[model samples]
Target: MRRRKLHNLQEEFINKFLETIENNEEYLEFINRHKPELLSNCDIAIREVKFFDVFNNTQLNNLIKGISNLNKEKYSIDLSLMSKKYKDLNYLIIQYDNSSTRSLCEVTFKDDLFINNVRAGFTQINNNQAVVEFSISFKEIMTHNLWIDFIKENKELLYGKKFFGYYNIGEMIKSAHFALIYNSISKVIDAALQAKLLSVFSLNFGNEYTLPQYNAIHVPQEHFKKEYFDNMFLCRTYEINNKYLIVDITSDEGLKMDLYFSGLYSSINFLQLLARYRMDLYYFLFEKIERFEINRRVNKYFLNSRKRIALKDYRWLINKIRSLNDNKLRENYTDSRELLEDWKSFYDGKEEEFIDFENGQYTKKYNTIYSECFDHIKMAYSIQKENLVIYIATLSLIASLIGIVTTVLLG
Candidate 1:
């Protein structure tokens, strides 16, 4: 049997609906502007990407070998896309879909790593921050379970024991159809990435999702709802109105439709944007913790009572507290006008955590300083008053003695 090439299928698929889908000049222009730059350094521009550290020679070699060993005549998991490489990463764009429209289930999980591209945004985490431009009407659906089994076989040989929980292939069999893209990635990558490949998937799909009874982790059905996705504002979904450029998908509730897009090529950029602020929030937390630690240590020293705290020391402590004020940074990040309202909202929410940290820890520190300083000031005043009183008493006693002596002499 002559195997149909995925490129031919993609061309046919795009051409069939090309007239309706290609009408968006704005989106087309956007793609045109960025596509060249994104694809310039690579041989295969349409392949999926897998990232690896340059130092992980063992993992990288195994990945390349797996791709080399694939039987070209078999399933639609195209090996051609995996041929290209740039630096320590490989691009393996999937041109085939293995899941049906009615089959894909709605899932809700918080995955920080899936969209985390903060180091350099698009330039750095390109391996993990990918755009899966898929249309729901698959020209072919391969056995997703077969690909899953392929990943399980690589548990020891490719991924090793440290990444066992990460490769937890068991969790994926439930949504096997929709998740095949990730599962295929597990096997196709021989060894280039050092844990990040699995990390990307684990971070993407690990926490919240509903699988069929065959694969359920026992989440109650009543708890799941479409409203859950409303809170997932950070999640970017693009739909194809027409057949050519538009991507298609089915809702977990069994609704079938092409995903519509206002012309953002991918959510990778959005992920990067949020990642920047997420990094800021993380640093903010780190600083707050450090301030708390410093306050604790200083309060302990003040409690000792033997060490003298002077007026100047009180001023220094106040200055240190003032320095911990991240008000400006908070204001800058939580800008209402500059950023999207949802992003701004997220920033504000994270900033609240910072405020709570400051309020709780700093309040304790302030009270300790206030009590210690107040007692020191009061004790100093008392000492001066006691000296004055002693001097007056001595003078009075001398005067009495002088008076008595004079009287006796005169007599």
Candidate 2:
């Protein structure tokens, strides 16, 4: 969470990765010959943490109270006394008392960072319907080379691990519940999720001297003047728009300030929250996939209804974004306008890709349902027609018999 240590580690990793690649003769020759300016911009990778257990409003309230009154054990959940039906105890929200630490994440919730603002609870996610979420965030400034295995490596870190819930391993208690199952998750182990890392490769590398190398990105000079800030020496801002500003510092100290100001301290926070849209997309596909594999007799009506509901939901969401983008909600981010634009392009492109994928998936499923239903209808119609033909023949034969009998009697 401390800036200096993270900065040094990233610097070391980048240099190590690049230097190690010297063993690759072809790559070395190409870089030497070409003298290519290899600069990778910083990237922020947002990750999500979720639990499958569902918590009703009452349970959510109970958890909130327990977190609020951390000094008391009265609200502490007793595993033995609770119902067997109760699975894992999950937190919809955890509001640590006035002692909770504050950081960039607090800014996302519009809370002050220096003081522990108990009002701003750490949120792993913005969704109030969550089963449990402990949102803790900090930043990483990585070079492109480091990304080769940086994320995977980061996952193994116990950097900021903390126990947020209750547990007693003594007295044959394996967890918060069911000793045999021992699967009760009152603790979110290895809690830090590597939500995002910002890579710092410059788009314009050669012009490092004339102007700030990181200052290659341009915006209209009128909006974001460097002098507009309270302490110009601490950081610089390049205008992205009326609402958005870009960080324009060339040094680590400068980047730190840029990270704070342009990042709005909570930029990653906002992003992590927005990232939930992805969860919906994944869940929708997951449900359909499960249905296909597990349910042998998927009904036509259910398929049709699902198809319509998904289409409508996506359409509404897309339209909502369009409306927002029309006027455009403005926010700023670090090190050049290019980095900010990259985030926008990344989000927009992914949104479109996901929507397109869902449309294709649901469309295919609906067609399968319709085809099966149509075949059944056709078979039923054929059977009814055959019965009608047999009935007509029987009536004609009876009439013929009656006519013959009448003729004989008359003669």
Candidate 3:
């Protein structure tokens, strides 16, 4: 649970960091100099081990520990040969490729065990010289996120094509199979299983389903049973970490909460990639908002002119305005008229009072969007005050107002 909480916190931190950098000029300049190529390549391909077989090995305990060690955790191996003294066993082996995508293998040879089944198949190794390694440990395999981090932090040295395998030492002598054949067969089975899981999960969230937002619905858990989705959704709220509370749509318990959350995480990751690449878009819009407000006040042409801007320009402006409607600005925007009044005061040569907001550096910085949107609408009102009769310009200004209203009402 703690690890999951930390994962959610890390995700939130990444999003806020993306937002902050995109909104700041000096910070962007720093990025262009230091890490400009970050989002240059976004066409990523994801593949995984899909199948494997259960084989007998004298060193199964050591092998599982080897898999666990790839994730930065130390493991002590315990091995037992079916001698007269001991007979209990629970062990696993994990095989992965150069990208560090993994497949799990479990072996339970105890006579008293309830479950016993083994499947295997073959897959080609892309790198001939790659060495096979494993992690054998007592630590739970639940923290897959941290394990990926361990591989990524050392990817340069770890690159190699590989797959998974489980060898049955007890059957090898009788079966007459080579070591390489055992490895190949096990990986094939593992790959098939992995593929099945991915297929089922992917289809569950395809285009037709729209996950519900918990914040929009009130589920009465007291009268409804767990079998009812509404009650389940409300009960599931307790399972969500605070860091994921505001943004996680899965808390509402739609058709498939697990897949919804997984897709949501992937979507956020893709957005971060966009944030890294189109950082200039953010800066451009932020500056545009400021300059537009300041120009409306200082330039007479902007105040009297009734020119309609392009639809694209209006859309960009609308998105920027909506961004300011987050939780941080909810209270500030309670009275829209008052909000606009304060913004007008800031624009009419009171720039110093609003410097903190203009720069997106105020303590109430989360309210930066609210402040920016308010200032923008107020500026538009001031611009059209004299010539409200010009239909195009009047409509343009009204369109901007409608953008904010639509975002608040529907978003």
Candidate 4:
């Protein structure tokens, strides 16, 4: 049985390689020149290894040997280049591998033949299928006003015929953004086109967009209607003057399109801008949680709830706690010793006996619920911070009045 499994795995790998080479001319040429025998061996092996126990030790050894000899050097996934095609526009991309460890990099460049460069680390986790990261600083792009001027100055170059060259900026941006939410990206594109809000702009382009193919642009508000049940924001699109465009996006509660628009590039740098906006919010909340030393308790709360607390439940908890701030009930704590003992009983090498497939499905359902609950909590935090600031300012003003009164009485 094990022999068959290994052979089947090898067959799948071979099929993938064949398909890749057949579809990609560059790869096909590389394979033909370096390893013709490897391809033939794969085809023959598939015919011989059909049954569960067919492959003996020698056959398995030969299969491994043939694969190792293939010209795999040409298929390396790495970010090999970052160069500006336009005078003002700079491009950044890395060849990515989703099958392995996460890859992160820092991008830096400047105008006027490479001046002082800045560096920031970018780490991309798998959103689903595409390996994507949002560490690039879109704030580096000039404001919307300057971008307009740049577009006017080089409309023909950015949107003209010359922009269709290799490594096109338009395609890259689309690829990058689509990587973030590829499953829903097509819906966003369709909605944007229906709204008729497609346009390209750049402050540093010499008609680069015109030279390359442009992917359909999308804005979230153009499509998604605010649903009462969706406690988190999904990708959406909006229409302006009969043209479909992306207007707003919601990820978590603290993240909104308005917050992103407030940053430097409200429109031109869409993907990177959204990423920067999310990072700011994520880090902001992370710092607050760490500073308050609430990670352990919050995490425990999530686990106990089976990660399925509803949005309404989240609001209720926050409001109830807010009302009970000074009450002894707020300070009352449950001793965890008994709970720990119970957990330990399950931990003693008997987890497999108790946990069935149904538990996995149940966990997923609850996880969504728990995520929505956290979104509401984040919104509550934002409100709490605003109130805190107002309270401090009011207290300061009152103290100043008391000091002024005391001085006058003494005089």
RMSD of 3: 29.1
Please report the candidate that would top TM-score against the real structure: 2
Off by over 4 Å in 4: 1-103, 112-128, 134-141, 153-157, 160-411
What overall lDDT goes with each candidate model? 0.30, 0.29, 0.28, 0.28
lDDT string for model 2 (328-368, tens) is 11111112233234231112112222222222353345335
Off by over 4 Å in 2: 1-22, 31-37, 40-140, 144-268, 271-411
Can you tell me which runs of candidate 3 are displaced by over 4 Å? 1-315, 328-363, 385-411
Q: Which of candidates 1 and 3 is the stronger one according to TM-score?
A: 1
Displacement of the residue 334 alpha carbon in candidate 4, Å? 21
Residue by residue across 34-124, what tens digits does model 4's lDDT show? 4643332222110000000011223223322332332334221123223232222112222222112222222332331211221112222
**What are the models' TM-scores?**
0.23, 0.25, 0.16, 0.19
Q: Please say which candidate is ahead in TM-score: 2 or 3.
A: 2
What lDDT score goes with residue 233 in model 1?
A: 33
Per-residue lDDT, model 3, residue 376, is 57
Write model 1 residue lDDT over 1-411, tens digit each, in one string: 122343343333223222212343543454456564423211111112222121123333334444444344421232222333433444322211111111111111123212222111111111112211111111222133332343333323332222222222333333333234222342232221223333322221111111100000111234323333223333322211211111112222111111112222232222323223322222222333334434544554446643544446455455434322322233244332233322211121122223222223433454465556546545654665788799899999999999999999999
Ranking of predictions according to TM-score: 2, 1, 4, 3
- The deviation in Å at residue 102 for candidate 4 is 4.4
> What lDDT score is found at residue 92 in candidate 3?
22
Best of the candidates, lDDT: 1
- TM-score result, candidate 1: 0.23
Worst 10 residues of 4 by lDDT: 45-54
